[model samples]
Target: MKPIVRVVRTGTANLASVVASLRRVDAEPVLCADPALLRAADRVVLPGVGALGAAMGTLQGDLGDALRARVEAGRPTLAICLGLQLLLEGSDESPGVPALGLVPGRARRFDGDALRVPQLGWNRVEPDAGCRLLEPGYAYFAHSFYLPDAPEGWAVARTTHGVTYTSALERGPVLACQFHPELSGAWGLGLLARWLEA
Candidate 1:
């Protein structure tokens, strides 16, 4: 049977592209806002595309608790783009708002003075040794805020745009990417496939 991947309905993510990408990998994608489903699904994908505050608002109560429980238990979870940011303690984009705190640190804006603000287009992701799902490839990135350093004890992958930052992180069954794998062509699909296999 195809893996049933429950995708959190963050109200701001590009669900269509994420769903289509999962289908390409032969996984059954279910767009869900229900907290119970999120907690119980075998695999879960958290994809976000808009402001941190807005996404957090949608995830404020039970949905937030379900995600926290899933990640804390080391369940299979993939957090992409803003989803990755949401895993952190907080973000400069929305001050005073607490995130899931699954990973240490907070999201900070990329230095616009050094390079482009929202590092668009494809960039190389150099995976560290021991990473199970990430590979060295050019993944599509579209973000202004980033985690400057990898959280301690997690398998890390770095990418450079203005400054080098953590592009992907993996620990146990939880994987998070600062880039958009769903829109990243073959490399992205391969990443998703690997995640499904895990």
Candidate 2:
């Protein structure tokens, strides 16, 4: 079946970057800014950048409503970077905005209070052997904020910059990743391709 991935343009989200990445894997994707077209999509990719409060606000405003509907219908959704952060209940970055409430947890900044803030550079992402999207090697990460602990059994993968932290999360059919697979080389591209194939 041909996949129709909807790219959400909300808050500080970057849709073009996601489009470029999906195209490299031959995934036929489309930018769905309109709520009508977005709701009609088969599968959607929720990718983003920028702060949590503003990002979550945009999601909650309009895009989030459409996403919640799509997810409730059992459609496939992929959340990357800040997009993943939007799935949580709240983020310390902006508690006022309120997250999607999909996962029972809060996102926080990595200020090296235990690890390092703005974890820049290569780090190993050890998948739990159950993560089908994992490439069995290190995936590049460039973020200052991430989910510390993903509730009980939600976390699927982790990474270590200075200390071990949750890097990937899975709840139901939604797969959210904190790193940029598109910039992580062949392994990353392979992961994107795998997700598309799945």
Candidate 3:
């Protein structure tokens, strides 16, 4: 039987592409926002787009708590783009708002003085030695805020735009990506396939 992947309804995510990508990998993608279902899922994909505050607002209360508990328990989860940022403590984009805090640190804006903000388009992701799903390839990135460094004990993947930042971080069954894998072509699909198999 195909693995049932619960795609969280963040109210601000690119659900169409994400759902299509999961289906392409032969997994059953269920779009859900229920806290109970989220905690009980075999696999979960937390996808987000647009502003951080708005996404956080949608995730407040039981939904946010459920996601934190799921990741803390080391369940299989794939967080994409703003989803990755939501895993951190907070972001510069929205001050005084607490995030899931699954990973330490905050998301900061790319230095506009040094290079372009948002870092739109494809960029290289250099995976660390122990990465299971991420490979060295150009992934599609569309964000202004980024985690400056990798948290300890997480399998890190780095990418450079203005500065070298953690493009992806994996620990146990939880994987987070700063880029949108659903829109990232073959390399992204391969990563999704590996995650599904794992």
Candidate 4:
């Protein structure tokens, strides 16, 4: 039977794209914001594409607590873009806004005027030797803030924009990506398939 993947509804933009991507991979996708569904998930996909403050606001109280518990137990979980950002301690985008803090780090804005903000295009990512799902290639990116410092050993891939930032993180059953695998065409679907298999 196909693995059940619950897409946690964090009220982020491009959520539908993620669902479609999962379906392409042949994994079952359940669009859910309910805490009970989150708690019972065998595999969970936390996808987001909007402001950090608003995202955190929607995942308040028991829903937030349940997610924490699930991650702490090392259940298979995937975080994408803003969902990945929310796993950190906090973000510079919205100062003073607390985050889930699953991965020890902070999301910082791009510095210098050398590159445009939001990075609205495809960019290459250098995966760590341990990252088997994808080889080094371009992935879709659309964000202004990035996690530059995420404790040692957490980052499984790195990409350069204005600076070398974490492109993906892997620690146990938890996986996160700064880029949108859903919008990244074939390679993206392949990556999602690998996660589902895990």
Candidate 5:
């Protein structure tokens, strides 16, 4: 199946990271920001990073409408990092920013003094046993905040970073991850290839 990979297009740095990740998965990523661009593909993949408030603001004001329509249509979709944060109603990290509310719960940092902000490097994200999004290995994560928990029927996979946090989610054909699959090396690329197969 063809996946219409989309980069949020907020900054060059974010776009570069996305480009690198998609190429690793061997998927066709489109540069267009318009919702109509999604019409050409069978699935959607959204990759993002940076501030959640700013990201949600753009999605709400612009891409939000388009994405909502696309995902609701049942075309498979996925999100990574800030892309995952944009899935909720809003984040406690940055108050007042409206989110997609696709999943329940708000986002927050490590919430502990011992743990570092922006937990970097490789981490193991275990699947819920019932979750279909994971294999047996872990995914890469680089972020300060995380989804505490997605409402029932939403959470598909999870990982520990300072604390156990939601790592992946699925609602219908929509699949999202709190980790950066592209940066996870073999595991990440393999995950993308699998998503395409699914």
Candidate 6:
């Protein structure tokens, strides 16, 4: 059977694009809000956009607990952009707003004259030795907040906008990206294929 991927729809702006990306990989996409469906999914995708505080508010109570439990189980999981931000300890985007804390560190707004906030458009991601899934290429990025100090072992890929920042985090079955592979072109599709095949 084709893989069943559950997408967490917590009102992220780019949820549709992520679902389309999964379909491009030949995976069955299931739009999910309930924790039970998330726990039962073959793979889980947490894709988001918009304000961190609002996203957190949308995922409170049982939904948050279920997501944490799934992460703890180390199931195949993927988070993108704001979705990636939500996994951190917290974000400067909204002070005192608690995140899922699945990944260590905090998300901070981009600060530099060389580039504008939201770091729009494509940026190249340099992958680590273990990141066979991601080739050195530009991926679509559209976020201002980034995880500047991720846990030592979780960063699997790095990208530079003005300053160096994490592009991807990989630990066990959990993989998250700061860029949108769906928006990215053929290389992005190839990267998604690698993840799906794994």
Q: Model 2, 1-84: lDDT tens per residue?
A: 456677787748766767888887877788776777777776678887888877776666566778877665656778888877
lDDT of 1 by residue, 13-40 (tens): 8799999999999999999999998999
Which portions of model 6 miss their true places by more than 4 Å? Answer: none
Worst 10 residues of 3 by lDDT: 110-119
TM-score per candidate = 0.98, 0.88, 0.97, 0.94, 0.88, 0.94
Screening candidate 2 with a backbone cut-off below 3 angstroms (N, C-alpha, C), the clashing residue pairs are 112-115
Q: List the residue pairs that clash in candidate 1.
A: none
Give the Cα lDDT of each candidate.
0.94, 0.75, 0.92, 0.85, 0.72, 0.84
Q: Compared to the true structure, candidate 6 yields what TM-score? A: 0.94
lDDT of 3: 0.92
Report the C-alpha lDDT of model 4 over 76-129, residue by residue, as the tens digit: 889899988888899998888899887788999998878899888899988887
Specify the poorest-scoring 10-residue window by lDDT in model 6: 147-156
Ranking of candidates on lDDT, top first: 1, 3, 4, 6, 2, 5
Which pairs of residues have clashing backbones in candidate 4? none
Q: Which stretches of model 4 miss by more than 4 angstroms? A: 132-134, 153-155
Question: Residue 147: error of model 1 in Å?
Answer: 0.3
Judging by lDDT against the true structure, name the best candidate.
Answer: 1
Per-residue lDDT of 40-62 in model 5, one digit per residue for the tens? 45666677777877666556554
Report how far residue 153 has shifted in candidate 6, in Å: 3.0
Pick by lDDT: 4 or 6, better one:
4
Model 5, backbone clash pairs (residues 3+ apart or across chains), number: 1
TM-score, candidate 3, is: 0.97
Model 6, 1-198: lDDT tens per residue?
878888888975667778888888899888889888887777888888889999999889888888888878877888888888888889989998999988888988899777798799988889888765667898999999888754776647889877898888877667888898889988788877777766
Q: What is the C-alpha RMSD of each candidate to the true structure, in Å?
A: 0.8, 2.3, 1.0, 1.4, 2.2, 1.4
